[model samples]
Target: MRRFFLFAGLLALLSGVVNAQDEFVTDSVLLHEVATYAPYKKYQAGAKMESIPASQVEIAQSAGLDQLLSRFAPIYLKSNAGGLSSIRIRGTAADHTSVNFGGININSLTLGQTDFSSVPVYLFDSFDLQYGSSSAVNGSGSIGGAAYLGLNGNWTDGARVKATASEGSFGEQLYGAKVFLGNGKFESVTRLYYFMLKNDFPFTRTSDGKEFDQENAMIENMGLIQELNYRFSSKEWWKTAVWIEHDWHQVQALMSSHPNVPSETLDNKHIRIWSEYENRRHALQYKGGLGFVHDMQVYDNNGEQKIGTDRLIAEIEAKQDVHSSFGYKIGAKYKYIKPDVYAYSSDVIDHEQSAAFYLSSFYTPLKTLKLTVNLRQELVTNFDVPFTPSLGAEYRLLITDLSVLKLTGNLAKSYRIPTFNDRFWPELGNPDLKPEKGMSYELGLQYQYCSAAIQTDVKLNGFYMDVEDWIEWRPGSIGWEPENRSRVISQGVELQSNTDVFLRKMSFNFRLNYSFNPTEIKEDQITSLVGKQLIYVPKHVATVYLIAKHGLWSAFADASFTGERLADHSGSAKFPNGTVLDSYFLMNCGLSRDLKIKEQDFKLSLAVNNLLDNDYQNQPDYAMWGRSFRFTLSTDLNFNKNK
Candidate 1:
């Protein structure tokens, strides 16, 4: 608390310090910085692309939320339960992809769900979606890929303000705002957002031959973010940021197939705080931070009508990095995390703390060629730690100023440690369990041109995970225990295409993503999940988007397809092998225009979601909301736009 107040005072004092100095002010930075020459755009369309300093990006996506989500059949996919669930990257399991905001890592407690609505889409300056294998510098939790979100800093002169409001079908409303303040010596950025939806979905089937009223759910989110950067010296900088988010959700929805599952209600809240500092040496950069999070949840279960759970966790990390003369950049990092969980009935105190150290190096011997290598190790008191290694390379051929060719590949070892709830919950303690480890490989290629560009990237990754003393729970067995799972192998391939056509002021963009996986269980008698396709994992999935932009008018249309998936791990008849839901495609369209009022910039947009009025569900057997429309208006005020 003392440190917090001290930092606050410094920020207050530094606000005036910047005014005393004179400097050329840049525009307010976005939260994340997209990359130019992005690998994924090789074969997709309707992608918002940008370029940042290459060294600044370890692994990330270079697209914005609006551009990425607009390409989907549905305008948006909601993950309201925990973390950010329902995340599918090239048809891989949600767990396969790793997501990070700023520098904080988030893990979900619930399965098959995530909280996407809470992410401040507009505040992010750039996003990097690294597909294939895992990044070693960020640790060993990823097998599919990693998505890194970047927040912007205050650099604009005077103040910059932006506000947006939108209304759509089903009582949907949205509001968002951003403010940037800066002087020569001090800078600050703040953001606010609110979204609400009262969806009235129409389902195709009902047990009583009557369509259900649709899942009625409402989400209220409040976020406060303040970042202050102070120049301790010309080469040294001190920074502190506070972020708080509160969500209130109420749901009275019907479960698919299990209509008798009863209407359910839940209330969940999350609070997080983080602070960091960075300094630059003659040739090295040093950075570190501390973060804390608290989660409180209450829900009604089938047997236990009233149940609640609370969790608190703290994490810390520090790193020192350097970029060398021959385009070689290297870094080392250390991290520690500890979490505590409490339930309504009894307080089960479980702690999972890890100390990790990693060394990573990237070298570009030639201007068009790059190579990267990484090695990492984790130390855990109660579990055996493993070493992870990764390698990647990128080659670019400059055909002409207007065209380019690129090639990329990667190989890595990754692992996932069971969460506290996964290993120590009252009804699910599995002491003999071992962490699952994976090895992955990927290769891709790209081609580009001036007027039109098309790129195709394919990744084939094979992974064999061994869970010695694997843990599982049976309904009538001797509670929860551990058993050796012998062997598990999961393999898949993901292919993507993105292309853009530009002629004078008109442009067209298209994108396609496809993925398939075949997972095999080699252990007999481990009936729980043996011979079963991983639950919630679709064997085939794809999305196509078409968009055009001309002058002040821009429009987009998209369609997404998801194939069959097993509802449970049991290979039994509960949900059969091809008991798949019919594949459905949805289309949506939107238009936007900008206007100048006095000295302010204003913009308006209207979108008609589910243009085809397709009745579809994202999850198997689940009831999805139907056709809807939305309209949005926004304004931007830059006091120094002319400067």
Candidate 2:
């Protein structure tokens, strides 16, 4: 406790020294920077798209990407004791959700899933979540949704630099810095971040009722990002970026029963470089990129395994505006993927190549009505992918100075190809597996109200999806093999609301989001598993956050609730009538004070997560963390020689 008190006292002293020039500043520096971007424009006419601003992203920088999503977004994160985390969107499998960074797909070609826990939140300036099927625009493997992380190259007025340092529970430390430099014709932004953690939290085993401390759990991560932009002419510009990340972590045992297992480790490295050129005068754009990823796992019991993947992508697009009421986009892309795995005393290599052509048309015949149509066709090397298409429409029902209401609907077809592991993994692979196909439908209503003192927004959406040829691994006469044996159906409802009120000297913001999703296996080859809920899928999830700010001090509280979910596919003798995980509720609170030291700005914040100390697990035998605390200090510096 001495350390806490010492830090608190130091902050108080600094606050007092900086408060002499008391000038009320309502907005944050991060928010001010985000405002420089062009106002967000909807890419999809009727899709459910949510963009998280830079200010909010900064609030959760120390917690990684998975924690940020679970606290604020409607998606679900399946965590293994804070080790590796995967995302599930709208009751879909982890592999069904596509992750993209700056127009490049970052999902692994071998495993087909991206680990959200390994990604740092500080690398990207913007986060966008697109709900429902987006295969028409994002290509295959987007059966549920798509997530996009982008870096904005729009520089500030002059040159600026920002730095942050944070410490948290379980011996976690983070340090990062960002630099921005620009004039009129040239601009550049560079970032460097490093984080380390020792995850040795204590937990109690549910089955045996015994207490134990986690062991052999540690993580070290480092990343760097560089972006540059050049404006050759008023209508022509070139942009390029490079990103590299490296991670090394020790793998812990699965359960308390195996605490004395041998040492295990996982290492990963990734590198990507991309460039794009756009000429608005000619209505043309061209982009291309190359990425490389290497992964290695060392285990005493299973020997060493290494996997490498390389991706090459190129695309050219054209846009035309025929009239004031209509516009269209046409694009063609080609992608080549090669994966090599070294396991089982041999080397396995495979190739996947595809070419896709897409066309999208938008029409605003009337001021109150808008329509969009999109179609895509892909030709794969060894698989026959069906034609995918989507249609969406939006109409304004009522409009006035105080309130507005809008209705939107969409229908789309999507598909996911089998991964390399599913097709050729020694004795466990099945080369006859077929791709999973899905059809989805959605309808939504949105209402917005604005006034001098208050602002409110509400949205409600309902969706349904049917999938065929769902892949599953089952025991065969010889051994376990992957097969296409199940037909799945999923339906859900989403509701969201946000309200902001401004008083004489204070402001309050409230946000609430809820999702009700139930996924089931409608038809299956196994009799015992038919008509059962899918594993690790929750029926209901909800989140709420309240913020209050007055002058330089601000406070906020967040609450999240997850409903009960099944643990396994079928019941067994050990787990009577099938294992089910109970529902859990978590609460978090934070307080921060902003100070102005001359021209620079400083902020100190203290946060407590899992306030109630809830004991729960998203995956069986993997206990979650207890109550934890985090402290962060950040500052921004501006340089202007003329000033």
Residue-wise C-alpha lDDT for candidate 1, range 361-383, written one tens digit per residue:
55656666667677778776578
For residues 1-643, could you state the per-residue lDDT of candidate 2 as single tens digits?
A: 3443343233222110000110111112011112221211223577777766444587788757888888887778888754588888888888888888755778877778888888899777777787889888888889999888778756444688888899999888989998978775687888889988888888888878888777777788889888888887777788888888887777766656556744577777788777777777763443343433344433333443667677777878777767656878888888887765764223444577889999888788887877888899998887888799998887888777666677989899998888878887887887678889999999998776666676666778999989899887778978888899999998999877766677989987776777889988999988777778887788887777777899998998877878888887667786655788888888899999999999788999998999989899887887678998989998888773432
**On a 0 to 100 scale, what is the lDDT of residue 565 in model 1?**
55
- Candidate 2 colliding pairs: none
Task: Name model 2 segments beyond 4 Å from true.
Answer: 1-43, 258-261, 282-304, 343-350, 573-577, 640-643
Position 33, candidate 1: lDDT: 19
Which candidate number maximizes lDDT?
2
* Candidate 1 residue 379 C-alpha distance from true site, Å: 1.3
TM-score of every candidate:
0.78, 0.90
